[model samples]
Structures are given as C-alpha cells and as structure tokens.
Target: MNAIQALTYANIAIWLGIGAYCFFLAKKQSEMDRRLNSLILQSKTENDA
Candidate 1:
C-alpha cells in the first residue's frame, strides 16, 4: 500500500478508538444521571411522608 493510504488508515483507526471512548463516557454519564434522579425522587418521597 502507499504511504498516503497507510496514513489515512491510521487516522481512521485513531478516530474509531476515540469514538468508542466517547460512547462509553456518554453511557456512564447517562447512568449517573439516572441514579442521581432516582436518589432525588426517593428523598422527596421520604420527606413527604
């Protein structure tokens, strides 16, 4: 393969790895948000009682 093609392939691979990391980070953030919301709702219910 040519040098330019190899360089492009490398760039694509790097982007793929970065995209995967971003996806997992977003998922983790979503989970944390859900847990936080649940905790807040629980507290509100407990306080109301």
Candidate 2:
C-alpha cells in the first residue's frame, strides 16, 4: 500500500482502539457505581435497624 493508504488504515485502527477503550472504561464505571449503590443501601438498612 502507499503511504497515504497506510496512514489512513493506521488512523482508523487508532480510533477503533480508542473507542474500545472508552467502552471498557464506561462498563467498569457502571459496575463500580452499582456496587457502591448496593453498599450504601446496605449501610442505610443497618442504620435503620
């Protein structure tokens, strides 16, 4: 492939990698939020008792 074609492919690959990384981070954040909410609920329940 020519230099321009190679650069295009490289750019596309980099964007895809970045998108995948962002998706992974978002999933992890949501999972952490769920766990934190659960802990908060448990604490509130314990306090009420």
Candidate 3:
C-alpha cells in the first residue's frame, strides 16, 4: 500500500478507538448516575420516615 493509504487507515483506526472509548465512558457514567439517583431516593425515603 502507498504511504497515503497507510496514513488514512491509521487515522481511521485512531478515530474508531477514540469513539469506542467514549462509548465505554458514557455507559459507565450512565450507570453511575443511575446508582446515584437510587441512593438519593433511598435517602429521601428514610428522611420522610
């Protein structure tokens, strides 16, 4: 392959890797938000009781 093609492939691979990492982080953040909301609800219930 030519140098230009190799560079293009490398750039695409880097972008794909970054996209996958961002997806993973988003999933983790969603889970954390869910857990935090659950905890807040529990705290409010306890306070009300």
Best by TM-score: 1
- Model 2 TM-score on a 0 to 1 scale: 0.81
lDDT by residue (tens digit), candidate 1, 18-43: 99999999999999999999999999
| Model 3: colliding residue pairs | none
> What is each predicted model's overall lDDT from 0 to 1?
0.99, 1.00, 1.00
Where does the lowest 10-residue lDDT sum fall in candidate 3? 1-10
Q: How would you order the candidates by TM-score, starting with the best?
A: 1, 2, 3
Per-residue lDDT, model 1, residue 24, is: 97
**Model 2 Cα lDDT, one tens digit per residue, 1-49:** 9999999999999999999999999999999999999999999999999
**Would you give me the overall lDDT of model 2?**
1.00
Kindly give the stretch of ten consecutive residues in candidate 2 with the minimal lDDT sum.
11-20
